[model samples]
Target: MKETPLCLTVGHLLPYSMTDFNTTDFTNPSTFILLGIPGLEAAHVWISIPFCTMYAIAILGNSTILFIVKKEPSLHGPMYYFLCMLAVTDLGLSTSMLPKMLSIFWFNSKEISFSACLTQMYFIHCFSVIQSGILVAMALDRYVAICHPLRYSTILTNPIVAKISLAVVLRGGMLALRYPILARQWPYCKTNIIPQPYCTHIAMVNLACADTRISSYYGLFVLFCVMGLDVIFITMSYIQILRVIFSLPTKDARLKTFWTCGSHLFVILAFYIPGLFISLLSRFGQNVLLHFHVLIANVYLLMPLVLNPIIYGVRTKQIRDRLFRLFTHEGA
Candidate 1:
């Protein structure tokens, strides 16, 4: 029997099998090279022991949020319900990219299978979109609780909230899944080196030799259309919330509102502001601001996973009490 050397594409938007690339010339792919950090120390600097620590703590923290909500039935309402969903999304976000990123950085495991890349892209974008929507849903919950307190329960019942959660997750998932399929349809005639840490859709789009007009349009459409729309709705919801808070005529109420919204605003700014800068830089600056771009990217991606648990959970007394109970409960 004849023997053929195994071929695999490392890390990515679409899972391209070498067998699939047989008809296509991938060896001499065009322009952009991944330019992985040239040295092991360099990769180590980007990802160190702390990276794994942060990643593990992030997963555990977010998982604890879901566990607390489930263990206590008093948390059966819309707020905690949405919180569990947020925790689930946070876990998805962290596990999607962090483990792979840290593996590459720490153990010199830079090589990632093509399918793994696609899967990463799908989950990262899906959870990110859902996170954005969940923030919007939370804002709505606040709005109803404060502005229309009388009708809050009547309006935000379990069935209604659950349906909204389902819709948000489904919509985000569908939006993200589209790209992997789209990428597979196209040929990878360009350089396959992904300069960034993970298989981002934008980076993948940058590698294509075919006319990227559609991909570019779709990227901008998702950003300006979907992401933009989510940001706008969040802003609008908060604006109405502020108006209600101001009208309350009590300092304590206003202060409480500020505290409640503060963590979310922090998360939003952590993810969006830098993300916006990176997006514009990629499109216009030709990756000139690479260092800042990468640093800001970590802020956008990992901060949410770890910070959400600390900011939201620690701030809420119920969560603290629940944690105390979880650990202090009678055990065998």
Candidate 2:
């Protein structure tokens, strides 16, 4: 069977198929229709219940963490300061996408304006990068506290923490700015249906009819430079932390030191493992199921946000005490 030519023009001799194909809208659409989890469309309502619940937990938990950290003078140290940064980043990360996702699932409102999609992409990736950097900062705080106990306070002072926070913000914003800029330059002559619920750099790039190699390469570059370096720095910091922990005099001392670092390590794993898995799956797992990819993507975005506050609250003794006292006092 020979394929019909998409555009054939010999005056009135042109076939109906060619005429229709040629007249088919090739211009960029002003808005995109997001098909939330392609194969699981019927289950979107059920899927949204958990997603909405996770978003609510993330918002409440992160907000509580921020409030407690702000009010507690005892938590004014570098570790708690970094925790506050993480809380804010988690809030931004979940808030960037969850509302639109819920709207898509519940009301079948999947249309997202072109500019709005780019903005969403920027915020989502920007906050994610900032969160990764903050995790590294937190790991460094632990390393200093454990490895250089006497100098910990001096090393990670308030001014230094502020500077690190500034650097994290600048790096995340600058790196993420390129995504929206590059995406905006691409002519989206293809279909405007983004497969995922949220707009991502690659997703927008994929909609372009032009050669997308540059965007693809750049996305990979940013991913490896930011997330890759972050993972390495975090790993090295924890390795040193572990070495110091093991070298401590007593078993109880070692346990205490490890316990202090345990929450951060769990948070780091929760943030990175699913993220890296999703990245790898998107890049290489072509044969993998589509619904699974969408599901993991949603999890990658929400799980750490929802779990971070819980993990820190339960694991950090001071936060637990503060929270308990706050609740009990309110009840009284």
Candidate 3:
């Protein structure tokens, strides 16, 4: 149907809209739907249940690890310290977005004020950077232990680990300040609707009206720099570890060394391969594939946060023995 002049003239009368309007009212979508796993309908309710349950599990799981480590005097070394940091980053990361996302899905609280949206955006970037930094820290710890055992304790002692952790978090927090600033630069005349569960930088860029070259460039730049540096650091650490392991007196010693790094290695590969997959798919895939991409995105983002504690707690002899004794005593 042709748009009549009378209809055009009527739209001019509405305050929320004007002839100057260059974009549609999708700035506030009728529904801020998730491009989630694609079966549609009230299936959204099922999705909310799983996500909320995962949120609770992630929080409790990481908290349990932190609590366990803090309670045990023997678990105060550099390895445990890095594990503690990983748990923290994971919990903070999930807590940063899951609650609000679940609320949006279930309670219909879709209208996030721009300020709140910006706040989420900031923490998301900050926590992600912190997580990457923690991985690098862990890789460095492994490097010291396997490469230079005598100086390992001296190099990764309390003060050094604390300094490293502090530097990573502060640096990430500083870099994250740019996101909200860049976010506000956009007029948002197009649509306020975000496609993903959280306020992602690229998602927000898609909603922008002004030139988004800067935001896109920065987002991709930071993404590559952080993830790329992490991959490089991890690879170098393992290479050194392999060299050191082979130099050891026996195959048994090498096996032990491999076992020591096994959990950390698993978590690293789990997080990265899927992240690369998601980044690739997000760039090229859609519908079912895109839906799958987002699901993997959440899992990869949460993997270290959820898996760190469990991996360390179960794999570390001291932590496991303490928990075993605790349970054994309770049974008595």
The best candidate by lDDT is 2
Pick the TM-score winner.
2
Alpha-carbon local distance difference test for all models: 0.68, 0.80, 0.69
**Weakest ten-residue segment in model 1 by summed lDDT:** 6-15
User: Against the true structure, candidate 3 has what lDDT?
Assistant: 0.69
Order the candidate numbers by TM-score, best to worst. 2, 3, 1
Q: Model 2 segments beyond 4 Å from truth?
A: 1-24, 279-285
Candidate 2: worst 10 consecutive residues by lDDT?
7-16
List of clashing residue pairs for candidate 2: none
lDDT of 3 by residue, 119-238 (tens): 887898888887777888888988898899899988987999999989988878987888889877766656554545666666666666678787666765677776677789889999
What is the C-alpha lDDT profile of model 2 across 89-178, one tens digit per residue? Answer: 989988899999999899999999999999998998799888888998998898899999999878998899999999999989998898
Q: Which of 1 and 2 is ahead in TM-score? A: 2
By lDDT, highest first, what's the ranking? Answer: 2, 3, 1
Model 3 Cα displacement at 156 (Å)?
1.5
Q: How far is candidate 2 from the true structure (C-alpha RMSD, Å)?
A: 8.1
Q: Candidate 1, residues 8-73: lDDT per residue as tens digits?
A: 111111112222112335743333332233223365654556567778888888888888888887
Q: List the residue pairs that clash in candidate 1.
A: 11-112, 12-117, 30-190, 30-191, 34-193
